[model samples]
Target: MVMRVVVIRVKILETNQQVELDVKSTTVRELLLRLGLTLSEHIVFKNGEVITEDDIVEDNSEVVVFTVKSGG
Candidate 1:
């Protein structure tokens, strides 16, 4: 079977630029690695809800990846 992929452009706060990524995996973790990103303690949200690396991303899903920071 041929799987469909969706490429979504996400804006990263640190870079202030849009990164177009093609997701064609069964899990979000695969997509991140394919985009050359690592899943650390930082949080990742899909439409505002926190999602884990094991989360399955459906077609046309909009994902936002952000690194968590702590400061006083």
Candidate 2:
């Protein structure tokens, strides 16, 4: 029997925090939720490309998140 592990690197632009996670499969939304973040309040980028919350994050991938801000 063999087991597979997926590791993802995450970075939060606002907080300048970096984390590495070991997961089998996960979506951007799930990752955000795990990190105590809100979907509508942040944007996700996978390997320098923008990705939606529903998008599945790949193994050994880099995920970057930026907080959304609105000002008048």
Candidate 3:
């Protein structure tokens, strides 16, 4: 028997780029680290809902990353 790994699609709104991660599952923090993004610098959204770094993101799911910006 063989197991199949589904890819997770991550779309970065700031960079306008999309990347695929091959894994069974991953945490938002891990995903950010893999993409070289900082938790404080970026915000993650899964299925249009904001997710925390501790949140678990499964494979084959679409995620969006937005750069955090502030002006004062």
Candidate 4:
């Protein structure tokens, strides 16, 4: 059996905290959930474009997740 490797880049907040995760999921939501990330108000961008939770990612794709902050 051959396994495909998917490289996903994750960026949290406004900082430069970047991390790479290897997964074999077809959708972004599946990858996030697998990485133990709970989707809330955080915005996710794939290759600079905003993507939904159901967005499917290809192999060696870069995914950036930013947490949006709101204040009173």
The best candidate by lDDT is 3
Winner of 2 and 4 under lDDT: 2
State every prediction's TM-score relative to the real structure: 0.64, 0.84, 0.88, 0.67
Error of 1 at 15 (Å): 2.2
Any residue pairs clashing in model 3, and if so which? none
Q: What is residue 11's positional error in candidate 4, in angstroms? A: 2.1
Q: Compose the digit string of candidate 3's lDDT tens values, residues 4-72.
A: 668999999988999999877999999999999999989899989999999999979999999987743
lDDT of 3 at 37: 92
* Model 1 weakest 10-residue run by lDDT: 8-17
The Cα error of candidate 2 at residue 26, in Å, is: 0.4
lDDT of 2 by residue, 18-72 (tens): 9888886699989999999999999999868899999998788889999997743
Q: What are the lDDT scores of the predictions, listed in order?
A: 0.66, 0.89, 0.92, 0.72
* Alpha-carbon deviation at 50 in model 1, angstroms: 0.3
Candidate 4, 20: how far from true, in Å? Answer: 1.5
Q: How many clashing residue pairs are found in candidate 3?
A: 0
**Order of quality (TM-score):** 3, 2, 4, 1
Candidate 1, residue 69: Cα displacement in angstroms equals 4.9
lDDT of 1: 0.66
Tell me how far the alpha carbon of residue 57 in candidate 1 is from the true structure, in angstroms, after superposition.
Answer: 1.0
Off by over 4 Å in 3: 1-5
